[model samples]
Target: MCTPNDTAVLHAIFNPSAPFGDIREDKDSNIQEDPDLDSRFPADLLEAVLKLELNGVTAAESGDVKTAVQKFTEAITLLPERPSAYNNRAQALRLQGDVTGALQDLNHAVELSNGKGIAGCQALVQRGLILRLNGDDEGAREDFQRAAQLGSDFARQQLVVLNPYAALCNRMLRDMVQKLREPDTQDC
Candidate 1:
């Protein structure tokens, strides 16, 4: 359904802020263009990582998923271990229906964050939505549970569709972790 030059199409979908399912772009209002930050970073290998990030954000906002992906990839190349970059890129991939790519980025973000559970929670929520969209409901549920336990209110909201279930899961998971931490309580 997407052409090779879908970057233009993607850009159009994002800029204008279309409805929830109908992402469209506003090409006329693109007020900013990056001036090659990498070139200024060094005389040789310019690490334009920040510039790439801005481009990624703009392209994502404009519904230009392909360009967003390229921009994010460039940022990753400049800073391979940055967690937020991966998380942001995952969001753009999800918007473009590239659920697999999004999941990969989210997984990488989680791994790079070392379970700090801040951006990791955001990545988990994105992964959960991708799983749900891809018909892996059980996986989606697990991801959402992890995200909610990490204190993500957005993930918790999604879980609350089954309020009692979500609460039970949270309590059980927390108690389990607590017990593990207190070896004396592990018998429970």
Candidate 2:
């Protein structure tokens, strides 16, 4: 999976003084002054994609939603079918208050594979928040329901806070949490 993009991202990361801002800050407004990010690296398609993915993850972890989005976008351009890229982009979008865009990416991530259920549930939580922000309680409720079914405590917490009478959701939440704590019996 090596690609040129990976090399470029490694260069940027190893050089802390590099122009690119980490995800924890506002990259768009802050990055305009940095010049080092303009440099290019020679990488293959897979490497390039990997680099972008790595950058996106680092940016998001550092709290720079815009930078994360940019890196993830670059990754998507190189490999549009990669579910992880879409999921990372969705997270950055969520941090930016762009719930609709995040939901769209989450949908793509979920559609790509069965392993994405947890990630998709996380997306549903963000989508539910956006719905609440937009004054669409019903929409939020639906998203929360899906998220809860997928075993997200955050979703169930929201539901309980929103309505004490949602006992069924509460029971499901408890069951899901219990399931998460059980140790695996299979040994290697």
Candidate 3:
């Protein structure tokens, strides 16, 4: 069982710079831009949300989780329907040892994205990590599976780690190594 501290270590291991997850660059071609979403939100409100979200990401990267959370909260207030703020805030909350809060924010993020966009995929992956750390293997697996289907490489890697067959193979290999190391009892 991984403790919260262990989870933090794992985050650093998986992504050193961002820890929780890397901030998606705005110009990344891989991320789909929803014209409908753009049309729905007012330009000023969208700008505010984007600015606050970027500030939150910067704060998170600088290890100022509280500040990150505050920024994200402001972004969410500006555009509650946007998933990015919630998703980013979830990461900050998780790092700050607020797992329940993080989970709530992630849930909101997933809901806002309708489990379809890049934001949703990131939220799923983050939630899956939280579930895994909390010892909810089945739930974690489900989230990872969904995120993988949404084309998240991080989720795909997590799936490999969570695969029972891979774990069993590793265990068997360890056992074989241990047996080989033991002194033979039979006479030569």
Q: Best by TM-score, which number?
A: 3
RMSD of 2: 15.5
Candidate 3 versus truth, CA RMSD in Å, comes to 6.7
Candidate 2: regions farther than 4 A off: 1-51, 97-100, 113-116, 164-188
Model 1: per-residue Cα lDDT over 44-87, one tens digit each: 33336667878888887777888988898888887776675788
Tens-digit lDDT track of model 2 for 67-161: 98999998888777656677778878878978788878877876763322444555566667767888888888888877677655567667776
lDDT of each model, Cα atoms only? 0.67, 0.65, 0.80
Of the candidates numbered 1 and 3, which has the greater TM-score value? 3
Backbone clash numbers for all candidates listed: 14, 14, 0
**All predictions: root-mean-square deviation over Cα?**
15.7, 15.5, 6.7
Question: What are the models' TM-scores?
Answer: 0.58, 0.53, 0.75
Q: After superposition, how far is residue 77 of candidate 2 from its true place, in Å?
A: 2.3
TM-score of 3: 0.75
Per-residue lDDT value at 70 in model 2: 94
Clashes of 2: 14
Candidate 3 lDDT over residue span 1-188, tens digit each: 86645654665666554434433333432435466765689999899888998888888888888999999999988889888888889888988999999999999988988876678888888999999999999999999888878766577778888998988998999999997899478845
